[model samples]
Target: MSYIQQSFSVQFEYKVFFTEKIFDTANTDFANFLESRAEKGIRKKLLFIVDDGVTKHHDYLQDQITAYFENIDGFELIQDIIVVPGGEASKNDLQLFYWLVNTLDQHAIDRHSYVVGIGGGSVLDLVGYVAAVSHRGVKHIRIPTTVLSQNDSGVGVKNGINYHGKKNFLGTFAPPAAVFNDATFLATLDERDWRSGMVEAVKVALIKDAGFFDWMESHAGLLTQADPASLQYLIRRCAELHMAHIGGAGDPFESGSSRPLDFGHWSAHKLEQLTDFELRHGEAVSIGIALDSVYSWLTGMLDADSLDRIIKLLKELRLPLYHPLLEIEDDQSAIVAGLEEFREHLGGQLTISLLRAIGKGQEVHSIDLAILRKAVNMLRDKW
Candidate 1:
C-alpha cells in the first residue's frame, strides 16, 4: 500500500477520470476499514482465500493488516486456505467449488460476514461468486494485485468458475463493495503473467483510445519491462475502458441483447475453451481482436491498412498470433466450428462485432466463413 500521495478517492457521481485513485490515505484506508467494520459490531468469520501461489508468498502486503491490525476487535478473523495449483487449474470443476462452499458453511459464514479476495483473477472470480451465492449473498471486497485482475477482471461485477471445458461457464453479476489497488504488487508479476495482462490493455486501446495505442507503440520496449510509471498508466487506462462499458450498459449479463464490452471476448472466451485455457485470457483477446479485425475486413467493413496495423500492433505486444493448441484439420471448417461457440455464447445469433476502422467497430450478422478462413490462415502461419 503506497501512500496514496493524493487524497485519492473518486465518486462516479462527481466525475470519473482514468487516473483517479479509489483510496485516499491508502496506508490507513485498509486498516481503518477493518476497524470500522469491527466498531460497527460486524461479526461472523472474515475468511481470506489464498491459493498455493499466493500462500507460498514469501511476502504479502495484506499481512500488514493481519499482523498490525488483527486486534481491531471487529470480529474473529477466520482464515481458510485453499492450495490451488494457481492459474486456470484453480477454476476447474464443481468439486473445488463445493469445497469452498463447504468451508464457508462449516465456518458458518453469515450475511454479516465478509470474504476478502487477495489474488489474481481466478481467485477473485471463484471467491467472489462463492460469496455472492453463499446464503444468497455475502459481503466481499477485491484487492486486485495482478495487472490482468486490476485492468480487466477486477472492475466488472461478474464472478464464476469455468465448467465443462468452457471458460466462466457459470457466473452471476455481483459487484464488490470496495476494491483496493496496490501498484506495489505489480512488482512481483512474472514476465508471462505481466505480458498476458498487457493484451487486454492493448485491446482497450484498440477499441477506445488510439492515442494510447500510439503511445504504447512508441514505448513498447520500455512498457514490456514493467516500469512503474508505464505500468501504473496502463493499469489505470485499461480499468477505465472496462468501467466505462460496465457503467453504460443496460444489462450486466448476456440476455436479450449483448453489450459491446464484449468486443473481442466473443472469440476470446471460446478460444480459451477451444485451447483449454492454456493460453492466457489476455493472449486470447489479442488473438481474438486480430481475428475480428480480419472478419471486419472480409465483410468490407474495415479497410486494409487498419487490418494490417491491428495485427502488427498486437504483434508488438507479444501476444500469440495463434496457438498450436487451436490447430484445425481444415482452417475453414475449424473457424466455422469456432464461430459456432461465439454465436451460441451471445444467445444463438450470428451477431458479430467487426472493426470498421481503428477505434471504430460495429456488430452485424452473418459473416462469411471463407473470409474467416483466410484470416485464420494468415494468423495460423504465424504460429
Candidate 2:
C-alpha cells in the first residue's frame, strides 16, 4: 500500500435557546443569534420555510418575521417565506422535497445563506434534508414549534424523510447551525397533539431518569391538563437527556447497533407507517413502550412492580397502550416485520433496548416471538 495517512477532526457546536414569541422584536434572542453569525462585509441571506399548521394558528407569523428581521443589522430575510403542509405527509411527498429544493435554487440559497425550518419534527426533517443536499450542504436553523420536535428530533443531528412508506428511510446526519424552541407555539397544539407530545418525556424518563419518572407520576394530573410549567419542565428535561446522549455518549451519529436512546422506537416506527400515520409518533411510541415493558417483564429483566408503574404512568398520561395493527398474527405479520426492518436500519445486529429497571435500559440481540406474543396479549387483555 502506497497511501499516506489521512486524519482530521471537526468540532460541531450549536445552542438550543428556549424562548417565547421568538419573532417578537422585544425578544432579542433570534436577532442576537443572527448578529453573532454575521460577517463583516457579507450580508447573509435567511430563507424561512414554515409549517402551514403553524401559520394557521399564528396568523400574524409572516408579518412578524418580516418586521422583526427588518432591524437585523447584517442579514437580509428572504421576502417570500415559504409555507408547506406539515406532519408526516410532508416527509412522504417526494415532490414536496424537490419543490423546496427548487425554491432554494431559484432563490440562490447558497451555503452562506441559512435555511430556517419552523415547525414540528416532520417538517424540520424535510427542511433539513433539503438543506443538507442543496449545494452540498447549506447552513440551517431550526425553530421547533411542537413538544415532540423541540424536545427530541429538532435538537438532534439527524435529518430524514420517508421513502416507500418506510420511516426515515432516506436521511442524513446534518447538524443545525442553531435550534430555537419557542414555547409559545406549543400553546396552539390541539388536544391530541398536546397529550401525545408528552410521551417522549415519559419514554426518556423510563430508560434514563427514574427521578424524572417519579416527578411525572406525581404531576400526572397537571401534565395531563397541559399545565404550562409542567410541560415546560418536561420539554427541557427531555431535550437535556436527548442532547446529553447525543453529545456525551460518543455516538452522536450512531455508528453502532446499541441505540439506548431508542428504548421503544422499534415498533413505534412501524406502527406509524402501518397506521398510515394516523397514529402520532408519540402515540406509537407509547404503545411500543408498553409492549417492550411487558416483554421485559416476561423475560424476567424488569420486575412486575416496575412494570405496573410504567403502565400506570402511561395511562395517567392518557397515551394509548394498544393499537389494532400492533397485533402479531404470525411471522408474516406487518408489525413483526418491523423487527427485521429495524435491525436492517441498524445494520449489524438486531439490537433492541429493553427495560431492566425503572431508569436502566439493556440492549438485546434477540427476542422470543412467543414471549412477545404473550406480551401483546397481556396488553390487549390485561391492561
Candidate 3:
C-alpha cells in the first residue's frame, strides 16, 4: 500500500489537505495546482513565509524551496515573498502574524495572492492566522516541519499566536489550502525537539488510541532517542487519532482550546503561562497529564495502576511528570490561582477532560480549587 494510506486522513465533511511526501512531491503538486489556476485565469503570487531553522543550511534545503518555483504562471508574475524565523517563540504577536500581515499589506497582496508557511507548528499557526485576517482571509498552505505540527497543529487548521503570556490567545479557525508533511524534516531535528513532538503524539494516544499508547509504553525510550521506526509510528498514529475526533468536534477556531477532550491542558496551559514559554508545550502537557490523571485516581475515577502507568510512560519518554516551577510557589493557593487564568482566558466555564477510567474520559466543571490544591500538594510530595 502507498504511504499515503499511512500519511494522511480526511473525515466528517471537514476538508483536510495534505502532501504526504512533501519534499519529493511539493513542486509537482504546486505545478499542477498552478496549472489549474492559470487555466481558470486566477492571478496570485506565492508568499514563501519560512522558519529560520529551515534555512540554517542555507546552502541546500532552504534555498532549494525558493529556487524550485522561482517563478510560475510562466514567469509573468513577481511570484516571491519570504517571511521570518518560525517557532512557538516566534509565534508572539510582534514578529509573526503582525509582521506577515503588514508585509502582505505593504506588498499589496490581494485575495488572489496566497501565503505558504514553511516551518513547524509556530509558523503554521502564526502565518495561517495572518492569512485568515489578511483581506478577510486569503489562501494559505502549510508546510509543517516538525512532528508537533504535522500530526497535531498542522492538520487541525487552527491558527494564531501567544499573547499577553497566553498561548494561542489570538487566532482564527481557518483551514489551509493544503499541508505538506515530509518525514525528511525529522532528520533536521535534534533530540530535544524530537521529544517535544512526541508529547503531542502521547496526547493523541491518551485521548483515543489506546493501542497506540500501548505501543508507546513499550517503545518510549526508542521514541525519545529518535529511532526512525518509533518516530514514524508515533507520527502516523498521532495524526490519525486527532483527525478522528477533530472531524467531529465543534469549530476548533473559537479558543479555550475549544475542546477540552484536552484533559491535561487546563493546568498545562497555566504552567506554560508561568514559564514564559520556556517550558516546551509538550513538557507542560506531560506534567498536566500526570496531574490530571492523579486527580482522576484521587476521586475514584481511576485506580492506582492507571495513574502509575501514565506517569511511567512519560518518564520513560524522558518527559517530566512534574512542573519544576511549582516548587517555588508558596502553597496550593498559588497553584490554584494559576489554573484560574486558563478558565478566564477561554471566556467560558472551566471545562476539563477527566477520566472515569482508563479507556474512558469525560469532561467536568471546574477542577475545584480545593481538589486542585490537594492534587498539587500530592504532586509536590511525590515528585
Candidate 4:
C-alpha cells in the first residue's frame, strides 16, 4: 500500500459590527464595510436576500439597499431583493435553497461576489448555507435583525436548516465575512418576537455568566417594558459572551460531542418539532431551560435558590416554563426521543449539560429517565 500523509491549516477572521440604519446612504458604515473586501477600484457585486417580515416593518428597505449601493464607489447591488418567509418556515423548505443557488448561478455570483442575508437567525442560516455551497463559497455577510440573531445564532460560524423534522439536520460551518447588528430593526418587533429572543440572553447567562444572570434579574422589568437601552446592552453582552465561547472553547464546529452552548437544546429542538414549529426557537429554549433547571435540582446538582431564581427570571421576562407537548408520549415517538437524536447528532456517547450552579454547567453521559419524568410532572403541576 502507498501512503501520503498530508496536513494544512487556514485562518479565518470576520468582524461583528453594531450600527443603526445601515442602508441610509449618509451612513458610511455599510459602504466602508463592503469596501474593505474590494480590490483597488473594483466594484463588488452583491445579492441581497431579506426576510419578508423585515420588509413588512421597513417598507422602504429594498429601495434603500439599492440606492445605498448605487452611491457607494466599490459596490453594486443586484436589482432583485429576494424576500423569503420568516422564521422556521424559511428553513423547513429545501426548495428555497435550490432557488437561491439557481439565482446565484444565473447571476454568476462567484467566490468573490457576495450574498448578504438580512433577517432573523433562520433566514440567515438558510442564506448562509446557500452562500457557502455556491461555487465552493461566496463571501457572505449577515445583517441579523432580531435580538436572538444579533446576540447568538447570527454571529456564530454555523449555518443550517431543519430536515426530516430535525433541527439543523443539514448545514455547514461557514462563518460570515461580516455581521451587522442593526438596533433600529428591532424596534418594530411584536411582543412575541421581542420577548422570545431575549431568552437566549438568559440561556447564555445561566450557563456561562452569573454576573449576567444577576444583571438580567435586576433589569427584567425594564426589559419587559422594551426599554431600548436595556435591550441594546442585552444584545451586545450576549453576543460578547457567545463570541468568547466560540473563540475560546476550541470546538466551534462541534468537533466533539459536548455542546456546552446548547445547554438546554436537546428538548428544545424536540419541542419545536413536536409543536410542528408552532413554538418559536427561543420560546422552546425557555421551557427547556426550566426543565433542565428542575432536573438539576432533582438530581441535587443545583441548589434550590438558583433554580427559583432561574424560574423567576423566566417568568419576569414573560417566557413560558412549560409546554404541553413536552409531557406528551406516543407509541413511536416521545419528547424523550430528542435525547437519542441529540446523542446521535453529536456522534458518540450522550452528553447532556445540566446546571451545577447558576453560572456553571456540568455534562453528563446518562440521565435518570424516572427523575426526568418526575421533573416534567413537577413543572406541569406548578404551571
Local distance difference test scores for all models: 0.71, 0.94, 0.71, 0.90
Write one digit per residue (lDDT tens) for candidate 3, span 1-383. 54544576444233334444443434476556556556355456777787777766333654565556654454233344474775568877575556677788877777777687878888788888888998998878777778778778887768888877677888887777766676777788766777877887777677666778889988977887789878877887787677666655655445444564476877777787778778877788888888888888888888898788887888888888777665434435445665667677666776678876655677777665556656766777885
How many collisions per candidate?
2, 0, 0, 0
Model 2 ranges off by over 4 Å:
none
**Model 1, span 1-383: residue lDDT tens:** 66755567443321222222223334555655666566454455677776455556524534544564454465667644444456777788688888888888998888878787777898889988899899999877787767888888877778988877766778787778667776766776778888888877777776677887777878787777777888888888888887777776655555655555566777677677766677788888877887777767777888888777777767766777775544445645444576667676556667766666676557777766567667777778743
Candidate 4 residue spans exceeding 4 A from truth: 328-333
Off by over 4 Å in 1: 1-26, 35-39, 59-65, 79-83, 325-335
C-alpha lDDT of residue 351 in model 3: 68
RMSD of 4: 1.4
Model 4, 1-383: lDDT tens digits are 99999999778889999999999888888788776677985667899999998999999998888788777776678899999989898899999989989999988888888999999999999999999988989989999999889999999999988887788889899989999999999998888988999998998998899999999999999999999999999999999999999888888777888788888889998898888889989999999999999999999999999999999999999999898888844423478888898899888999999999988989999988888888888889986
Give the winner by lDDT: 1 or 4.
4
Residue 313's C-alpha lDDT in candidate 2?
94
What alpha-carbon RMSD in Å does predicted model 2 have with respect to the real structure? 0.7
- Overlapping backbone residue pairs in candidate 4 total 0
Per-residue alpha-carbon lDDT of candidate 2 for residues 62-105, written as tens digits (9 for 90 to 100) = 99999998898888899999999999999999999999999999
Number of the top-ranking candidate, with lDDT as the measure: 2
TM-score for each candidate, following the candidate numbering: 0.86, 0.99, 0.86, 0.97
